[model samples]
Target: MSAELYDFQDKIAKIPEQEKKAFVLYDVLGYKYKEIAKIMDIKVNSVGVYIHRARTIFFEENDDSSCRSRRPMMSMVWRLVA
Candidate 1:
C-alpha cells in the first residue's frame, strides 16, 4: 500500500509573511533557495531560516504533539497552489 499525502496550505497561512512566501516559493513552486533569496531580496542564508521556520510552524499547527518531538516528513505533505 502507498502512503497518502495531505495539503497543508491552510496551515501555512498562519505563518509569518516572509516565511509563508519562502515556504510557498521554495516548497510548492519548486524554487531554489538562492532563487527564493533573490526574489525575496534577502540573504541566501535567510531563505533557509524562513523555510525552516515555516516548516516548524506548519508542523506545530498540524500535529497536536510537541513539534520538536515529531518533525513532519514535509515531503509527504503537499501544498496546493491555486
Candidate 2:
C-alpha cells in the first residue's frame, strides 16, 4: 500500500520523528526488524518498540465509539451471524 492508503497517518504524524521513521519503515514498507535496524541505524528492539507504539496509537485514535457502532449494511448477514 502507498502512503496515501495509511490508516495511521494522523496518529503517526504525532509520533516523535525517530519513532515515526521507524514505524514507516517497518509497518508501511514491510521491512524485517533486522533490516529496519540496519536502515535506520537502530537496534532491533527499538524497531519493535516503535512499531508497537505506532499500532497502539493508531488503534486508540481510530477506534472511537462511533467507528465501532456498526449498523448492519446487510440485515441478512447480521441475522445469520447474530
Candidate 3:
C-alpha cells in the first residue's frame, strides 16, 4: 500500500469508535445506509450524519498544508479501498 493510504488508514483508526465503524461500513465495505443503520442500531438519517462527521474529522486531522492542497478525504479513501 502507498504511504498516503497507510497514513489515511492510521488517521481513521484514531477516530472515535462510532465514527470509525460507520466510516468503515459505508465507505470501505460499501454497505448501504439502511444496512449500516441496522448494524449500528442508529436511525438511517443518523448514518449519513455519522459518515459526514467522520469525513470532516478525518480531513481536519490529516490535512497537511505543506505537501498538497486539501481535498475530500473520501476521494482518497475510495482510491485506497478500490
- Top model number, lDDT: 3
> 1 or 3, which is superior by lDDT?
3
Candidate 1 minimal-lDDT segment of 10 residues:
73-82
Higher-scoring candidate on TM-score, 1 or 2: 1
The TM-scores, one per candidate, come to 0.65, 0.59, 0.66
Against the reference, the lDDT scores of all candidates come to 0.69, 0.61, 0.74
Q: Which candidate is the best by TM-score?
A: 3
Per-residue lDDT over 1-82 for candidate 3, one digit per residue giving the tens place of the 0 to 100 score: 8898788877787678888888778866778899999999999999988877776777675456342222344466667778
What ranking of all candidate models by TM-score puts the best one first? 3, 1, 2
Q: Score candidate 2 by lDDT.
A: 0.61
TM-score, candidate 3, is 0.66
Where does candidate 3 clash, by residue pair? none
lDDT, residue 42, model 3: 97
On TM-score, who's better, 2 or 3? 3
Clashes (candidate 2): 0
Give residue 26's lDDT in candidate 1 (0 to 100).
Answer: 75
Candidate 3, superposed: residue stretches over 4 Å from native: 61-82
State the TM-score for model 1. 0.65
